[model samples]
Target: MNIPDIWRGLTRSRLFWPVLTLVALAILNVVVAPNFFSIQVKDGHLFGSIIDILRNGAPTILVALGMTLVIATRGIDLSVGAIVAISGALACTIIADAPDGNNPGTVVFAVAVSLVFSLVLGSWNGLLVSVFGIQPIIATLILMTAGRGIAMLITEGQIITVSSAPYKVIGAGYWFGLPASIVIAGIMFAIAALFTRRTALGLLIESVGINPEASRLAGIRSRGIIWTVYVFSAVCAAIAGLMISSNVTAADANSAGLYIEMDAILAVVIGGTSLAGGRYSLTGSLIGAFVIQTLTTTVYTIGIAPEITLVFKALVVIAVCLLQSPVVQARMHRRKAAPPLPPVPSGTITTPVAAETAGVAS
Candidate 1:
């Protein structure tokens, strides 16, 4: 309620900057494209730039949601993109070769097969890092490099297109006046929120991330926690892959989910998860994914060059990152001769460094 308390609260809110950035982008889009905010009912489904952003960003949001937990476990998964490729490749291949790709049963079976494969791949990463004591980055890097090759082998270096109506519904179809992708992402987010907050898993993950030795001493199964996160991350990526390939009805082993890992990482960082790992905010990551998708939409709306669009997006991201950085904020406050803001409150689920410095780390 006091001035400093309010200031600290504002500064520590993980959702603040990402939400502000998203709103700013929306305004900018509206300025550039007056109809950007307009919503229309097409075949009983809502359609608009805003809806498109949510629909398109759903996969990234799903991936970032899983990455948030992985980072909270003091780890990362660079192979998400590759997993995406493999998932799509496997599913599409199976469907393509099916006697009736459009059969709902066939689509279901394909999806199941893809997810099972993703689980195995995720377990491989987990085994290397959790069981063999390999560093997370390096362990995941192995898969990151080789996963594409595996996908290529599965697809035989060809793009496999399918025409499964049920499969298409997973990505491009509309349901109940909204995008199916959005619905899927929302369900995934809700399940994650419940699995973590409504249970003790979230705390244990954070405890391990902050201090693995301490968590182990307390009898927490640190290895299992780490392995479970990796597996979950992979499964999330597989879902994203299904969404991507389903939207197009094609799987390109070379390009399916290409570079999505970087986008997911950026979304997580922008949403306030620290690469160093600890506490995390799935809400922030969700907003951050929207921010990214909105930025991409803005590029075309504002008539930015195709070649330089990435540069523009990168510059914006850099600016946002700098603005949200504590080091930069501290310097700005010092220049203004303002008292330093109080540290983020204990048990706050914002990011890593705040928790790390507040003795969350050993």
Candidate 2:
């Protein structure tokens, strides 16, 4: 495609900004550090420390996939992190309370209970948002605050430890030379892609996101779509909780998923979804998650204070937003329309749009 057509196509995609930003960041990293791309296997296990990032990032990617759907409908679920806390607590409690030495079904039972609880929490968000007309952020935040307390009640404000082998394997084991968490993330992405891209539901979601009232007038069950997304988001969070608990062999009532909602939200935004709603892309979200994971990994590798990573992350998010924004892109396009300036006084910008958005975040 020519520049204008390509620009328009990208503007139409949810993943465009995130992918472009990820490419730029990766290029910068490779330029600055020669060892950034090095990898080796040790002890029959892939030993590049970057693998650690991919492993840890899996859960957030899973959660983001569901969150993308929710946000697509002009809604947000602040309760997801809380749902993770709830799901982990419920799972750990069941495993701990299993019959002393013969709880062979502990894994099965715990997962079942966890799913049921997540479903109920999701339904609650949907009910308040749909049936009662509560704003999504308010509806989910109410649960977000209340859910943490519920998690503590389940665990009595304590972390729960377990020894179940299967439970541990779900989060800690691997298949086909990949970490289990990574594999689960892949499966979740595939399912999401199938639902959003291969089925008619994707169109419905985009329609509702673009214009819910119009969708209602056109005979779509907009409320049902809204409810389904919240439920799916909860289920995804539950899976993340399970993987998280499995990794540590324990679940912390207070910190299991603390503030992860922010990261997921950033991932969705970086992936290029409009906060106002509509056009969603799972591929973009996946790439966005990878970039976030990579940024975190890069910050750690460079020996910067870990705390500084958040600052870098915030900058990167801002950059991505500006790069993908129509306001910025429109200006970039205008630069092509103007005549090139001579190698002049070396201090003045020849293009106004570039000068306006170049250093400024959109």
Candidate 3:
């Protein structure tokens, strides 16, 4: 209702700092590029820096959404990037090998195959962790290392290209005057939000994440939940891979979705989700994805050297993490709550000895 109350409410919100960072980055972009916020109609489609941020950041957002769930269940998927590469590589290879790459049926078949293969890859990770008792990180890292090689083999160590108009629409076309990628991301976000929030799935996930042994004791199907999250994460990465390859009409196995797992993990962390597991925020991950994209855009817009861009990004991320740290927040609150020194009376004037005596007595 008032300034202090509003401040308190904002500080209490998990999304407060991430939203603020996004706003600050947007303001910075506006200052650097006068037309940064300006959107215009181009060929009946919206075009602008903001649109580009959403469109380009869509894949990361998708990956982050799934990562949020996996992290909530006390797990991580380092194989997401590899899955991304494999998805794109497989899809492009399928289309390229087809006699009619542009045929809608062929495109659909390729997409289906890519997604199905991604499921298998995801199941592999799940099997290692949920069934075989391997650590999530180690289980995923195995695929992370081997996925690119698999993708390379799929493409025969070459970039696979295709010209399927229908497939291209998935990533590069416009839908209802908005980028198709944005639409797809939005739809997936809604599905994830609703699927978890509208059902008991969210509570079960939090329960499992909080204490898996306890959950299993209570008959909560902990293993199934863990396996499901990994599978879901893999599917998300596959869809992202499809969008990326579709956008460029080509798939470079070596370069596709490189280091994207890092971005997705960063997004989940920046969204205020703890790596320790339990409790999560999809909305926060969405904002964090934008934050990452905005930061990347800022680096290029500010003309930072290529070699220094990573350093600059690291600095900003470190600052943000520190600000979000509980220790830092507690210190800030203490300073805010500390009482001010009592003001001296208007006519009061004390000699040095008197002041010293008063100070000592107090």
Please name the candidate that would achieve the greatest lDDT relative to the true structure. Answer: 3
Clashing pairs in 1: none
RMSD value for candidate 3: 6.5
Could you give candidate 1's per-residue lDDT for residues 259-321 as a string of tens digits? 899899999999998887788888989988998999999999899998998899899889889
* Model 1 stretches with alpha carbons more than 4 Å out: 1-8, 333-362
Residue-by-residue lDDT tens digits, candidate 2, 251-339: 89799999888888888888777778898877777787888887887776667797687888888888887777888876765645566
Q: Tell me model 3's lDDT, rounded to 2 decimals.
A: 0.92
Provide the TM-score for each candidate, comma-separated.
0.90, 0.86, 0.92
**Which of the two, 1 or 3, has more lDDT?**
3
Better of 1 and 2 by TM-score: 1
lDDT of each: 0.91, 0.85, 0.92
Report how far off residue 227 is in candidate 3 (Å): 0.6
lDDT sort, best first? 3, 1, 2
**Residue by residue across 1-362, what tens digits does model 3's lDDT show?**
98877887687677989999999998998899989999999889999999999999999999999999999999999999999999999999999999999899999999999999999998999999999999999999999999999999999999888999999998898999999999999999999999899998999999999999999999999889999999999999999999999999999999999989999998998899989999999999998899999999999998898889878877877877787888987776664456788988874655888778878988
- In order, what is each prediction's RMSD in angstroms? 11.1, 10.4, 6.5
Q: Which ten residues in a row have the lowest lDDT in candidate 1?
A: 328-337
Question: Backbone clashes per model, in order?
Answer: 0, 0, 0
TM-score of 2: 0.86
- The parts of candidate 2 lying over 4 Å away from their true place are 1-17, 24-45, 100-104, 335-362
